[model samples]
Target: MKFTTLLFPAVVLGAACPYGTYAPEEPTDTRGVCPMLNTLANHGYLPRNGRNINENQTVQALYDALNLTPDFGRFLFKAGRLSNPMPNATTFSLDDLNRHDLFEHDGSLSRQDAYFGQWSRFNQTVWNWTTQYYTSDLLDVQIVANSRAQRHTRSNLTNPMYSLSEVGYLFSVAENAAILSILGDKVTQTCPKKFADYLFTNEQLPFAVGWKKSALPITIQDLVTTFLAIQSATSFPPPPPDDSSVDIFN
Candidate 1:
């Protein structure tokens, strides 16, 4: 199925948490990670109400929630950098990381960590596939350019002091660029022409209205809207028809 077909439903379904279930008293705290996680959960990117706002998120938990372990492992192998292995021989989970204190269950996930993880996952899935399948170099260029365009300092993000808008802006920029690069010549055909045009012009995405304004903290709603916009613009090739003997994951 198309990437949008496969992933958009997840984003939509993420909005179905039981009423008043995981609503934190303060959902806009820049220093807290709960709002971000809650946003992801509510939008179907993660399990709804799976975690509390103040609970520390382990690297393993994040990877597991995102379903990135196996694919990331495959990417590492293809890059000729697969060294360590997780307990399960068939997959690489974050529990294998060598940092003892960092890998602990209660280890606080830094904003820097979240950004790097997102970068790695986006590189492995979108960038690598686009480069290989379409023989394109646009994604590589965008990745390099975006790395320099980042406005937030590592200290600020790592200290977990970022507002919701900051993270949303960062995500929108990187993700929009990735979508544009991957679609390439087919962008106009695949996505809404206006959305594609906006991305091509490097204009600020309309979805980032309020959050893009200041250092103001963000709410789950802001994240949801941003994600929905990104999802709406992305399209991927359809998967092959299923057959009992065929392995779809491969």
Candidate 2:
């Protein structure tokens, strides 16, 4: 799963805003476990209130802000919708996405396991472990892969209740893929560690750091290929499913 070397002259880069401007403000309303989604809300790509967000709103926001293809955005939103407890609901608030084993899962890059509770907020201790691997300004796929595998290892040893289903594992891999796709340089195949930190710690896009939306759209195939690259760099047992009967995601 090697990516071909791509060389494109760096385009003049600045803050890429789908909304009027990239002014990130504290959300006066609820936020989700996803740092990217929360960042989108903070930047006014989605409703600042983070409430009653429907599929169309989410899909459009992803497209406008990150240049994610509409179909890929819809795929992500479909997984997110599963977290909502409401049956037959097409809309979900950011808070609704906190449901464990659905969209949010254990061994997050910056978040703690659900067993510890308060899992939505940033955890510095967990983050510190990951930061050690950010040895350079640019985080390549292998570096990102190592960081993710290390986090999973730490959680496996520390969190007694830590569990990740097959689906959860796939989502976990895709998350890192999304980060790289959204914030990394397409020609270089790496993301800025500074930009990654800003997104995780502040839950805001690093517009101040001169990041712009990728000139090309991020497709589902792009994400899937990155997922395979990450998966190859790490190994963990297929975790048993958590004992919860709610299987709405199927």
Give lDDT: candidate 2, residue 102. 78
Candidates in order, TM-scores: namely: 0.22, 0.83
* Candidate 1 residue-wise lDDT at 180: 33
Tell me the deviation in Å of residue 23 in model 2.
5.2
Candidate with the greatest TM-score versus the true structure = 2
Q: Report the Cα lDDT for residue 37, model 2.
A: 86
1-250 in candidate 1: lDDT tens per residue? 8999999777764454443233322343211222233333433333333322211232223343332244332332221112123232332222132222222111111122343343111123332222233323333333323332332332243535333354344443434333332222222212233332332222223232211111222233333343454445444335767688977688
Candidate 2 Cα lDDT to native: 0.81
After superposition, candidate 2 runs with Cα above 4 Å error = 1-28, 236-250
Clashing pairs in 2: none
lDDT of 1 at 117: 42
Error of 1 at 14 (Å): 11
Consecutive 10-residue window with the lowest summed lDDT within model 1: 102-111
For candidate 2, lDDT tens digit of each residue in 25-60?
554788878888888887778877788888999999
Task: Quote the lDDT for 57 in model 2.
Answer: 94
